[model samples]
Target: MKRFIAVLVFAVVAFSCSKEKGNMVVKGQIKGLKKGTLYLQKMNDTLLVSVDSVKLFGDDKFLLSDNVESPVMYYLTFDGNTQEKKIMFFGEPGEITINDNVEEFGWKPGISGSKNQEVMDKFNEINQQFKLKRLDFIAKDMEARAKKDTAAMDSLEKEYKKMVRRRFLFTTNFAVANPDTEAAPYIALSELFDANLYLLDTINNSLTSRVKSSDYGMRLQKFIDDVKAQEKK
Candidate 1:
C-alpha cells in the first residue's frame, strides 16, 4: 500500500537523523536563548570550523558534540559568529557542561568537567594580578610624561621593562609547572610565544610525554623550530 511505503521512508530518514555519540559531549544551557543556532567550533589549520550545531525553538538548553582526536581549544559560538560572542575552553574527551547568559555570554561563562580548563583557570587568576599591575604602571608613566619629568620618566621606563620581564618569567614557570596538561603547551604558545628562546625551550623540554604529543604541544614545538630556522637565516 502507498501508506506502508511512506512509513518506511519516514523511518529511514529518522534513523539517518540520529545524533552521533562523539568522544567529547558538550551539553549546556544559554539562559535567555529561545530560538537560535549554537555551533560547536574549533580551529582547523587556521580556519574556524563548525563540527556540530543545534537549533533551539523554545528551550534554553542545548547539546552539541564533536569527535576530539586530541585536546584542543573549542569555541561555543552563537548564531555561527565568533566576532562578538563566543565561549572558549580547553576541550578534552569527556562530558563538559557550559552555562551562561546571552547578555554576558563570553564575559564569564561557567565551564566544568575538563581538567585542562581548570589548570587554565588557575593560571589566569594569577596572570590577572600581573595585568592589573601593568595598568597601574601605564597610568603613572602617562602622568610622569605629561609633567615632562625626565628623571621620573626614565625610572618608570626601566621599572616597566623589569615588570614585563617578570611577567614573562612567571608565565614560563607556570607553563613548566603544568607540564602534564595540555594547558602547559597552550600557555607557552599563547602567552610566551615572543619570549626569550631559552624560556620557550625550557617549557618545551619540560612537557610531559603525553602533552608533547597534544595539538598545542605539537604546535609549540613547530613554532620553536621555525623561530630557530629564522634565526639562522
Candidate 2:
C-alpha cells in the first residue's frame, strides 16, 4: 500500500510537469505598424473566446504563450479589430512566427478590426459586395471622364456617395452589434468619421495634426499608445 501511494504521487507530479511543457509561444512581426494591439482568440459559433491580448512593440514584434491543446485554430488580431489581418496557426506547443505587412493587410489608422477565419469570411463577403458595386460605378465614371461627359460623371459621383452612405449604415450596425469583436469598434468608428467628414474635413485633413484634435481620433490614438507602451515590457 505504501509503495502504491508513492507511485501515485509521483505520477501526479509528472502529469503536472508535462502540462507545463505544453506552454505555446506565439510570436510574430507586423510591418509598417509602429504600435498596435493584438489578440489571440479561439473560434466559436456565437462569440470568440478571448484567450489573450498583447500590444506590439515599436518594431512591431509581439509574443504570447499559453498552455493550449494540439491542433487548435488560434487567431491573431491587431487593435482588437475583428477585421484586422490575422495570423493563423496549427501547432502543438512551441514557437510560431508571422511576418506580415500591416498596411497591405488592410490595417489602416483610425479603423478597428480582425482577420480570423470566420471573421475573414464575413469580411470578404461584405467587401466583395461593396467592391463590385463601387468598381462598376468607378469604371463608368472613368469612361465618362475620358469623353468629358460631365453629366455622366456627376451622376456617377452622386451614386457613389449614396452607396457610401448605405455602406456606412450597414457597417455601423454590424459594429454596434459586435462591440466585443475587435473589428467592431474599428468599423463603427470608421463609419462615424465618414459620416462626419463632410463637416470636419478641413480640420481632419491637416497633415501635422495631433490625434487629440478630435474625439474619435483621440480615443484611437490613445488605444494605440497604450498597446505600444505594453510592448516595451
Candidate 3:
C-alpha cells in the first residue's frame, strides 16, 4: 500500500511538470480568411522553420501551442489564395492573441499578451519616422537631378548622408538605453551592423549579462568577431 501511494505521488508531479513545459499558446483570428493556412515559424540559423501550423476551412480562427525556451521573435505566415503575408512578433511563454483582417494583414494587427512584443512595436514606430525622412530625401534628390542642378545635387547628397548618420546614431542610442532587453542586441546587430566597429563594440559591452547571454546576443558577439577577423586581413 505504501509503495503504491509513493508511485502515485511521483506520477502526479511528473504530469504537472510536463504540462508546464508547453505553456506558450497562440490564438489567431482573421476576419476574411475562410479557407487558408497559418504557419507559426521561428528562425533556425538562417532559415525560418515552421514549429506549428493549422489549416482553416470555413473558419477564421486557429490555435498554436509550443514550449518556448526563451523570449524570441516568431513569424505568423498567412497563405491565402491570392497573396501571402507575414507578421513578426516577439514571443514569450504565455498566451498571445492576434486578430486582424486578412485583407490588411501586414498593415499591422492587434497583438497582445507579450511584453517584449510591446517593446518591439514601440521601436518600430520610431524606425518608421526615419524611413519617411529617407523617402523625402530621395524625392528631393530626384528633383535636383531632373533639373540638372549640380550644386543642388551636391547639397542634397550631403544632407542625405547626414540623415543616414542620424539613423545610425538613433539605433545606437536605442540599443544602449535598452541593454537589459533582448531587442537591444538584436537591433545592434541588425540595424547598426554597418556602423563603426567601435560603436558596435560599445553597444555590445553595454549589454546586461542576461542580454549578452541570450540567443541574439551570442549572434551579435559572433558578428563582431567575424568583423575583427576581416579587418586583420
lDDT of each: 0.91, 0.56, 0.85
Global Cα lDDT for candidate 1: 0.91
TM-score of each: 0.91, 0.39, 0.85
Which of candidates 2 and 3 is the stronger one according to lDDT?
3
How much lDDT does candidate 3 score? 0.85
Tens digits of lDDT, candidate 2, 137-201:
98898899999999998889998999988776665555444433334333334444545432233
Write one digit per residue (lDDT tens) for candidate 1, span 106-147: 889899999999999999999999999999988998999999
Summarize candidate 3's per-residue lDDT along 1-233 as a digit string, tens digits: 99999999999998856643357899979888888788888998889798877789999998887778767899888764233567788888899999888888767899999877887788889999999999998898899899999999999989889989988888888779888888888788778888999889989999999888888888899999999999999
Candidate 2's displacement at residue 4, Å, is 40
Q: Best candidate per lDDT, number?
A: 1
Clashing pairs counted in every model: 0, 16, 0
Model 1 worst lDDT window (10 residues): 77-86
What's the distance in Å from true for residue 204, model 2? 20
Total clashes, candidate 2?
A: 16
